[model samples]
Target: MNQAIDAIRTFNRFFTRHVGAIDARFLDTDANLPEARLLFEIARLGPVLANVLQAELGLDRGYLSRMIARFEERGWVARDRLDSDARARPIRLTQAGQAAFEEIDGRQRDAVAHDLESLSATERDDLVQALTRARLLLDRQAPDAFTIRDARVGEVSQVAARQSVLYAESHSWGHGLEVVEAETTAAFLRNSDAERERCWVADLGGVMAGAVFLTDEGEGTARLRLLHVEPFARRRGIGDALVAGCLDFAREKGYRQVVLWTHTVLEAARRIYARNGFECIDTQVHHTFGEPVQGETWRVLL
Candidate 1:
């Protein structure tokens, strides 16, 4: 326990120093760290309740009230009482506040770029994986505790990256997997049909825990693509939920049937597909990922 505490403290100290290197004075914009924090938080989740903000950041109520008042005085924020609860008020960034946030955000990005500009691609990947593991451990998020939502801009590539990393680590799949996933994902976005297809991501604690894509395959048939969940985030019914969501969307889109291709080795996913009414229609051995694997095609009548 002492060693774990010491390790955590060491990381905390290192992070503090890292931020100090980034900008100790909030990029010299007259705002201290706390104020900068408040500004950025408000900017992202503005129109958010003060109590919610305080709770999310673990800020003292009194301290948060003071900082909010300061922002209001600077014409950077405004608060409006909630109709449901008079004591509850939501804070929002004013136009001036938004401009300030943009400036601060831009500066922060530039500072980060300048700070880590020397790292190679491999080093950056290492750092990101380290950070992801740290977050997954520290947040202690439950496997099923995730929100299924529409895949947003720039997240498709992230989905590909997540799949790449996980597959490489777990299955020893080569770069070919990432290449196919990336190309298919990009094409999914480029040629998305609003009425016929959809993409859903399992957003676990703001991280991409899993993702599933449904694409139109013409002839009243829809194809389910890229169905996967992070290993750490498995077994919480996320996979089932994602598959169900895709099926529901397909039904809503008037598809007569749905089909999916899966590797036989993916037992968990196979179970999910089976539970969701899919039946294996065909199978073939392929050396797609530089190894011979049995791939199965499953189909279900909608």
Candidate 2:
């Protein structure tokens, strides 16, 4: 625990340094980091509101008011008057504010692009996945930022690899798990019926953090397979959302029932299945994932 705390602290310090947060002027601009971010938000989300900005930035009401006042004093923003609720005016950027935002945003983009130029393609991809994973763990903020979509070409392996690594880390699942995951994923891609069978990936800011597969089991039954979410990306409805996607697809394909197999060790996933109206219909002690385990079969009538 101490080691983990120290590692997180070290990374926090490193990130602040990397972003030049120690500087008085952010991006060498007139405003500091918080003020600069507020400026960007106003320009992007304007005609935006103070309360919305306040909540997004996690700033105290008084602090955000002062910041907005400062921007208004500088002629960077103007609040449009509200007729009914005079106290709740929306803010918008003036030409001056627009210029300021463009300057700061352009500089920041250029700086990040310059930094990325130093890394190889593989390293860049790894860095992005790592950063998004960290943010998801810290804020649990992936629900809105994620979109469910059909798995793209070559993503079958990606899904399998992510699921395999996550399960191995969280449950100490053995090598056979990866082998099975890879096999099933490849088979899905190779033989799945586009209308009756499908796999969806929860794309979190371009990273595949969760996946579920719906496959025809003959006679109006669809089986959900390989429902998994990265540990850092769990508990934010990604798992449930994946399952929902599976059930929705199953229904649309005219399937009468959906079934899934899961282990008793996966309580989180069990809840997801149950929440989706699936009932545990059978259980058995099986030697799988390198150990004896209570496996469950759940089904939902559509």
After superposing candidate 2 on the true structure, give the runs of residues whose Cα lies further than 4 Å from its correct spot: 44-55, 59-95, 116-127, 141-145, 168-172, 186-196, 216-221, 235-237, 251-257, 275-277, 300-302
Residue 22 error for model 1, in Å? 23
- Candidate 1 ranges beyond 4 A from true positions: 1-10, 15-133, 138-144
Global lDDT of each candidate:
0.85, 0.87
**Per-residue lDDT tens digits of candidate 2, residues 1-302?**
99999999999899899998878888899888888889988887888878899887899999999999999999999999788888878999999999888988998999999999999998999899888777777876445467899987777778888888888888898787888898998898789889798888888877787888899989999999998887666666888889888888888888999998898889888988989999999999876577888889999999
Q: Candidate 1 on 9-98: residue-level lDDT in tens?
A: 998989877776455467777577788888998988879998889887899999999998888899999888987889877899999899
Question: How many clashing residue pairs, candidate 1?
Answer: 0
Candidate 2 local accuracy as lDDT?
0.87
> Residue 45, candidate 2: how far off, in angstroms?
5.6
